[model samples]
Target: MPLCSGYMAPEYAMDGLFSTKSDVFSFGVLVLEIVSGKKNRGFYNSDHELNLLGYAWKLWREGKGTELLDKSMGDVCSVHEVLRCLHVGLLCVQERGEDRPTMTSVVLMLSSESASLPQPKLPGFCMGWNPNETDSSSSKHDESFTVNQVTVTMLNAR
Candidate 1:
């Protein structure tokens, strides 16, 4: 019953840069949610304040990718297939649009057992994006962003 607005691609939510690439990011988030049985938004993890993508990426980097899966589905699906989907999901959420796979490529990767896949880099919005986090470069950043609202625009000229 909740909207997972956090799954919106960073490049889109921050700057309104909608494209096929943005769709790919959203798809990745959905895949992660499905496999992990976690809401992309309104997720809570005491280990970190990161969103689903951020936490999933962390788990992947730690070589604990299987831990990100939903335990309920353990008996129903192949772990290899699940891991492949996780890999593809991470690939789709890469920070740069050009690095993301086209839908056709993603489909092939998902369906083929022999497909050669590349390791995925960090996801967009990789950090927790905590405003309370203090940085030494505070003077170089904007401090006016409120808790529930970000005055983002298509230009994103801030």
Candidate 2:
């Protein structure tokens, strides 16, 4: 999934940032993308920078989570189950790691019809700026700084 490739890359591990919670976030993103048939990254509109997660959040908050479902899957899926999945997915992607549910909790919420789920907090990195706009001078400088830091750290560890 994109999360494994994006957030959980080995480079992130170098910073000791890898955690089960991060995996939960990735899984949540995957679930939303799968249900919506859209990519979470680079999802945009003229009105908002929201990825699929943001869209889902807005729908959920508006009591319209069902609206986020893929139209192709109409009547083939249970509305309650779909909503529950969306809720769990949102919980997994909350900005605060501590606010995110564990993968075990996610599995339970997905599998059990009777489980009570807490409301999900806001998701992380929901900014709408085009991620590929590395053309800006400031972005170039940031990239160089990151690359240099990685190089120096690696050399020092070796």
Candidate 3:
């Protein structure tokens, strides 16, 4: 199976499990990226080394969720709607698969303005990885391969 580490849920990354909830988690990442106009992978913040999700979570907790909106939008969208979408995005990226909302629930949450949203827990895969940990793996091996013309790079447990 083909995999991109950025969108993989913690359970799938660590345990090789995939399910609807995993899809939901990916969707959540997509939503945050869309709102912030940033990629979840390789996202950089000067103040912290957090990924896009962690940065979004931090902004949301600090009551600065509006700061996450793509500035180029220039008031073209409703602030309420944008924040609502961000809230739903956070809900979908909760650390535990079971804590994530189903796609059905996601649709309803996005469409309903009056409905209340629950607080989001810590998101999965939000921490930065160590750059110098080559010897951490028990096995000593080096291999290279490619899929669909894309070269396989480093592999790490996120």
Give every collision pair in model 2. 49-128
Question: For residues 44-103, could you state the per-residue lDDT of candidate 2 as single tens digits?
Answer: 545645657777888889999998888999899999888888888888878767788888
Off by over 4 Å in 2: 1-16, 131-158
lDDT for each residue of candidate 1 in 11-115, tens digit (9 for 90 to 100): 787788888989999898888989899877666456546767878888889988898899888679888888899999999988888899998899999989888
Each candidate structure's TM-score, on Cα atoms with residue i matched to residue i, is: 0.76, 0.72, 0.78
Model 1 RMSD in Å is 8.3
Candidate 3 weakest ten by summed lDDT = 130-139
lDDT sort, best first: 3, 1, 2
- Preferred candidate (lDDT higher): 2 or 3: 3
lDDT of 3 by residue, 1-158 (tens): 11225888989998999989999999999999999999887675665457788888999999999999999998899999999999999998888999999999999999999999999999998764333334334235564323466677998998
TM-score between candidate 3 and the true structure? 0.78
Best by lDDT: 3
Instruction: Choose the strongest candidate by TM-score.
Output: 3
